[model samples]
Target: MERWKINLIVLWLGQFMVMSGMTMIIPFLPLYIQEMGIHDPHEVAVWAGLIFAANFVSSFIFQPIWGGLADRFGRKVMLLRSGFGMAFVMMFMGMAATPLHLLLLRLANGVISGFMPAAVALVSANTPRERMGFAMGTLQSGSVAGTILGPLFGGVLAEWVGFRPIFYITGGLLFAASVLAAFLVKEKFDIEQAKTRPKMSVFSGFRELIRIRQLPALYSVTFLIQFSILSSMPLIPLFVQELHGSGQLLAFYAGLVGSVTGFSNMIASPLLGRLGDRLGSQRILAIALIGTGLAFIPQAFVTNIWQLLASRFLLGVFMGGLLPSVQTLIRQYTPSGMESRAYSFNTSALALGNMLGPVIGGAVSGLIGIRGIFMTAAVLLLLNALWVRLSLFPRNQVQKTGS
Candidate 1:
């Protein structure tokens, strides 16, 4: 097997473990706060929100710094740094005696979190350009699959072994992933070339990359893709309640509604990526954006949980095309020696989207209600599609077909 293929397989598993470990706390975060002697429901809610947001906030700020280092040092080293750093932090989180300690630990975890972006950089740098779409799509599938199953596994383990022990288990998973990467993942990095590369500060590197044609637009698309999809997530349970009524099965139905989209997304990501490789990633991105926008409309008006689930599933299928295409575009446009920095900037956009999505969603729901949030997201995505068409597709440039 080729070296790139080996890195892809190992990094795919590493990405899965990293994402899974990070999300495993989602199901019991609030419960953990409550256990920390927080009796008031409102206090628990506030602490949970703060603790959750802490990671994204730190990650958004530090991603570029790490990206610069990855460009100078090596992507595999950065990956190991994040994987092991997160492992130790997660284990210590199990030992946290107070909410403050947990909050600080989450912040530290965010600072050390670069495993996914580093994995993408390594794979992108090593893979054949013609197969970039397939590799990216395959890599994305692993991350999405982990995200879809993490909460489920976490919830079950939390019930069986309690909250703190779940943290220890998550830590163990991360450590094992790091060990695999250490032994198995290979990167053909030119150390002398990397050393001789011109040095630039983080912000300057970001500015230099942003000057590349089509990159800023691609970054915006990345942000909008995440913002549009995640903006409605927090309100799903409320929307489900409105459709199904508050019943004993509400939690089960809510989980189903949430997981169904990811299930379809996991299936569609690689298939659509392969299609993009043939049909042109720009074309697939345009169609997926339109499809996703239209899919949100049905969710806004769904009269029952089943209708909502179907709509979300359809949305997921289209969504599978968005990020991989964007990443491929980024790789195509970025100059040699700055791929990691470019990907890191993209990661920053993603972190911003993750951080702001729920806050804005909650605020929007308060103003226009949950249905209005859906409509707003649909409009934003549709407008994003127009932006892509105008900025990315030149009138004279013909779309590239198969490799």
Candidate 2:
């Protein structure tokens, strides 16, 4: 096998472990806060929200800094730094005695969390241009698969071994992933060329990258894709309750509703990516955005859980096409020496979306109700689709940039 192929495979597994480890705590986060002696239900809810957002807040600030370093040092080194740093921090999370300690550790984890972006940068830097779409799509599948399964595994392990021990297991998984990358992943970074390249401060680099024509639009698309999808996620369980009523099976049905989209997303990612490679990433992105926007409409009106599940599954198929196409477009638009920086900025955009999505979702749900939140997301996505068509697909630019 080619070296890039080997790197892709190794990094795919690494991404899977990283995503799985990061998400494993979600199922028990509020419960863990309660264990820390926060007896009031309202206080537990507040702490849980703070602890969860801490990671994304810090990650949004730091991703570009790490991206600059990846351009100067090497993507693989950044990957290892994040993988190892997250491993140790996650383990210590198991030992946290207070909600404050846990919140601080989550912040530290966010600061150290560059594994996914670094993996994408490394694979993007090394893979053949023609194969970029397929590679990115395949890589996305691994992360989605992990996302779909992580909570399930975490929920089960929480029952069997309790919450703190699940943290230790998650830490072990991250460590094992780092060790695997240390031995297996290969990068052909040119040390002397990197050393000779002109240096730019983090802010300067951000400005320089944004000046590129298509990049800012692509970054906006990245933010919107995440924002639109994640905004409805926090309300899904409540919506499920509205459709199904209270029962012993409520949790099971909620989990099913949550994971079904990811299941279809995992299946569709690589297929859509391959199609993007043949046609045009810009074209696929437009169609996917429109499809995703239309998919959200049904969720708003669904009278039962089965209708909601089917709508979510359809939404996932379009969701799979969104990010990989954006990544591919970023690569095509970025200059040779700045690929890592561009990807890092994109990751920051994504982190910003992650941080804001649930907050905005909760606020919107309060004002408009849960079903209306779905309708609002659908409208925003449809507007974004029109934005993509106007900003990214000018006929002359399409001919100039190629598919």
- The list of candidate 2 runs beyond 4 A from truth reads 397-403
**Candidate 1, superposed: residue stretches over 4 Å from native:** 397-403
Candidate 2 on 186-294: residue-level lDDT in tens? 8989978998999989899989987876788888888887787788888888889999999889998998998899999999999999999999899899999999989
* lDDT on C-alpha atoms for all candidate structures: 0.88, 0.89
Error of 2 at 375 (Å): 1.8
Per-residue lDDT of model 1, residues 43-125, tens digit only:
99999999988998999999989999998999999999999999999999999999999999999999999998899999999
Q: What is the Cα-based lDDT of residue 123 in candidate 1? A: 92
Residue 146, model 2, lDDT: 82
Cα distance off (Å), candidate 2, residue 395: 3.6
User: Quick one: best TM-score, which candidate?
Assistant: 1
TM-scores of all models?
A: 0.97, 0.96
